[model samples]
Target: MPERASARRSSRSFAAFDWLSVLVAVLQPDGSVQYANAALEQMLGVSRRTLVGSDFSQYFTDPSLIQSAVAGTHSHDFAAVRFEAVLRRLHQDGIPVHVNLGVGELREHLVVELWPLEQQVRQDREERLLEQSQAHKELIRNLAHEIKNPLGGIRGAAQLLELELQSPELAEYTDVIVHEADRLQTLVDRLLAPHRHPHEVGDVNIHEVCERVRSLVLVEHPLGLKVLRDYDTSIPEFRGDRAQLIQAVLNIVQNAAQALAPRMAQGDACITLRTRVARQVTFGRQRYKLALELHVIDNGPGVPDAILDRIFYPLVSGREGGSGLGLTLAQTFVQQHHGLVECESVPGRTDFRILLPLP
Candidate 1:
């Protein structure tokens, strides 16, 4: 083929495949990458110039697997091959992915597609979590209603008994009952707050929300703790409840600040509020072209593994004396805005990501 014609053909091919959502790469018979699409470059966290001409096997944890898969593409025994393998990336941990390998008869080159299993699993998990959250909200609302009436009766009876008591010492016992009943009522009110309150929707600037939370966190931890802002100035205001969004962000930042108590004592506590615009986000089974991504990241000892999964559940607190309703309320508020909140934690790092659709 002529050099200029071949160059045009290659550019056209890459342009045609660049818009694909899945990772794709054209490989030579020897398993060297000839061309990588945009999605593949983003997935590998590298540029096309760097990814192209590299050995395809270097990207996978098990090089022999890709080699065999590429070899199978050339074999007459199989028309196409699919297998699971761990993809290794520079300066990052390996990601388990499913690969589809096939040989293209037109170009006489091997084409490979990569799909991260973790991403699929994460999506499935998010769907389930949304469903579970709905169910939990319903249950909590009903349970709160059931307990509310009885709680009122208990508190009234305790007050009546206190008035009837002959001795002050005996009256103290009824006082204790009254106080406990009041506490229970408060707890029930909190459990039912999201359902009872009307959502007040208005234009919401995510940076304003972060700023409010930052101010509140700093007020609580004035010394030794540093709160940093990493805002994407290009993100425009969206429709949401400003107060609710502020509360949601505040709850997350408060939890992160509390988690950083140990680090604060060591004078190294740091929390970051990062905002970005994410494209092509799917939340609650609805796809949005643009969405707001706000991250509340902290450097702490991390959430305990045992309670990490249930951290957003009501009454499931990892800290002593914690009501455990912060994240629950945060999740509820974000859900009301048709958004999603997700958490990822390790020993030294914890990140809470809130995704909200933008108009």
Candidate 2:
């Protein structure tokens, strides 16, 4: 009866593993697969029944890596081991993945978890971006405060000087000072805009936001640019600030439009507004079952490599006469809605992806 109970418990646990997003497998001490979860089966493109008796190393291009990982776990060198390798699927090309091999307390079998290397790198990048964004916000706030006080005094002094001026030529000097001060004040106000307003939350349809941005982009670049929409209309509305979301998307699309000027002259400029639902996404160190993915993709000369990593930072513009606040504001607005904006650019393709968690 005890043996039957143990078997039943094992079956129940294995059944529950099917629902996990991460691929998992149970391996015997000799490296034979004892059990493979649904995610693992799907990843390997082979059923669990066929995988149970096979060597786990057979699924990887470098079998020795898996063998070493399993050996280390069995020898008690470590409770868990992790490494990067390429996974081979039946009749398919090898896929790069990160593997975590571990031995549970029972020590009956080794547990392995696999994550796509691209996804792992993306997750790490997002975490770093989040940290950098936080730091940037703090710095902007402090700088704005420091500049705000002296700015008023300077503007007031410029006005007083203008009033006391006798010659029109002298008046021009004070006029320059006042005008420059006012310009700086306007810039400071823009820098504070994201923090100044309270988010007005409502049910936001992402397609509507995209459409609004599309219309604006077309109006600005009425001649040569083609703004295309590839939306997954089935996505449900989530709660967010509609106006802010529209502005966020508009900034990215507008930037893309600006970048496409060269291609536009050649009659080949294209910007695609693509939207889809992403499942099992991780953002800001938390995992979500569903998230909205919005992409502003453009075919143009890509962002310069020097400023690519710092593109989201304020005052880091790749274009001449750009205020450099567009991407920063977009990122701030998205983060307000518990989302993130990421960019990947090559010579002819630049993709700006915004990920917002869904309800």
Candidate 3:
């Protein structure tokens, strides 16, 4: 009974690593695989059963490099080691990876993580995106307030001028002024919307929010766009503002729907709402143990490179006749929940991912 219970506890401990974004393994002192995470399983194109009890060093191009690294830890001074190497993948060419090996709580096992070479670049980009978004929110809020007072004053002056027009035909000039002022007023209101709302926090089921947006978008474009659900229901609920999340996800989904307008004509448009739980994700200079990953992916021509970087900025819209506040509002809402949104696009696929901390 004691042995079985200990085995169960170890199994539970390693299960958490299965959802991490990077490949992870618990290696025996000799570099045999004690456990292989889901990410590693997928990367190596092998099942956990095949990976466990195998010599982990053999998977790398230079087996002696890893064997010596494992052997060097016996000196007792080393806590961690990092190196760049090529990892051999099943049925694929060798992949360039940054390998990080660290001492685990149990000295008998070492915790090793394999990060794709691209991960560092992606992480740097994410950090920059977070910083830029912060700067944008502050600048936009101040700018919007500065524009608001003058806007109201201009509209009032125009209305008063229209009432005193000596030649009534000249009222057309005042009318144009008032019309443009109203449009600008609406824009300013949206810019301030995220700041104005009080967060009503509660336990949030992300799938519920995705379903709400899916139904709404489907209603708007019922016959043409297919809104598919790819959800991991095992994810636990977290504390958040349900309404704000709904709005955040809705805006992203709506943006994708509009982008898919061209594909809709041929009845092949698709927008996928994919949800998964990510473990040990780091962004905004903080590391989170677990996070909920929600992706709003569309089959479209992709975001224009000209405006792709500025999509989160207020008043930048990729679509013609768009108010451009949808994505800005979405970014603000997600950031309020201590999360970040990222985008990756190619000619046929545009994926917008929202990452929020999970309990």
* Cα RMSD to the true fold for all candidates: 5.3, 3.3, 4.8
lDDT of all the models against the reference?
0.83, 0.86, 0.85
Candidate 2 per-residue lDDT, tens place, 124-237, comes to 888899999999999998999899989899989989988888899999988898899899898899899999999899999999889888998899888889999899999999
Counted clashes in each candidate structure? 0, 0, 0
For residues 261-311, what per-residue lDDT tens digits would candidate 3 score against the true structure? 989999999999999998667766666778899999999999999998888
List the candidate 1 regions with Cα displacement exceeding 4 Å. 1-97, 100-114
Locate the minimum summed-lDDT window of 10 residues in model 3: 96-105
TM-score of each: 0.75, 0.86, 0.77
- Give the C-alpha miss distance for residue 81 in model 1, angstroms: 7.6
Which has the better lDDT: candidate 1, or candidate 3?
3
lDDT of 3 at 277: 92
C-alpha RMSD in Å of predicted model 3 compared with the true structure: 4.8
* lDDT tens per residue, model 1, 245-287: 9989999999999888988999999999998998645567765
